[model samples]
Target: MMVNDPNLFWFGCVLWLVIIWLIVSLRHSNKVDSPTESNTAGAREIEELRQECLRLREELQMQSKQLKTDFQNATFSQLQTLLNNYPSVRKMTEAKPDLPAKNLVSLFTSLDNLLASWGYEQIGSAWEQVPYNPQLHQPDTNDIAEGELVYIRFVGYREGSRILSPAKVSRTLPISSPSK
Candidate 1:
């Protein structure tokens, strides 16, 4: 029973070495788990940001579509009012021609200016004696003879590149001055 028996002391030293090894292994495991947990948290934050971006894009698209719809509805309503006012405004064109040429010239200019104010542009004119064109004019009668545009009652009106309405016209056979 020696207090410093070599076998017993060596056994105690070996036990202490085992205990140190266990503590070091537990510390290393905690370090590894800490990094892995941090990576998982980072990945979760990135996924949340992606979800938020997708939601914002959807909201922007919906707002853009609504704005487009509202604009179209407003344009249509304004166009309806314009069309309703057409007859009164059109009377100016017919009435101006009846005035004296000197007065009518100024009146005609004023009429053109007025039509411009209403978004109309006179593209070209046709004699009341030209051949009928279905593309340019809607014929009241297909049986009517060619070279006989009897009436170019109103000239075609256009806005930008689009025709709002074709000129209303009538056709007839050429007037024969009694061939003598």
Candidate 2:
């Protein structure tokens, strides 16, 4: 049947308008909800990545500390062994007073090699012909004179810029003339 009446035509137009408005509103709501949902998911992903980065940093710090501890332990053990053997080496040299100079040289070369491997060096000079400096040497007696080194009581050692030990020494004094 044809809708020839004015009232009926107006009702049909109103119904179609309501349907189009409902469709547009539903699409708009979906578009708005989609971004909100996607944003929430994005925020969760970003937080997870941040937590992972923090965990990795902590692990690296732990590994670095462990490596330092291990290195210190190894160095300590090596030094302990060297110190333990030092007395025997000294005794052997003292007992063999007539030992060849070349043999003594070889023995000192081996000792130097050992010290070098541990990042250490002998600090005192063999022939103390130079003037004594308070920074490098500790005077054994108060009467130690200025020029010549009389004797070395103990040898010193150095590691980099640090003085591990001081050289213990006695200096020669000029003899005083007897009054006539």
Residue-by-residue lDDT tens digits, candidate 1, 36-143: 775665566556655765675576568767876576446534654443334324444344444344343333455456566656664334324455555555556666
Residue 42 deviation, candidate 1, in Å? Answer: 18
**Alpha-carbon lDDT, every model:** 0.52, 0.56
Candidate 2 residue lDDT tens string, 45-125: 556655765675576568767876577446645664444334334534455556453254445556667667767665554
Worst 10 residues of 2 by lDDT: 171-180
What would the C-alpha RMSD of candidate 2 be, to one decimal place?
A: 25.3
Residue 26 in model 2: shift from native, Å? Answer: 32
Query: Number of the top candidate by lDDT?
Result: 2
| Candidate 2 ranges with C-alpha deviation above 4 Å | 1-110, 145-150, 172-180
- Candidate 1, residue 65: lDDT: 72
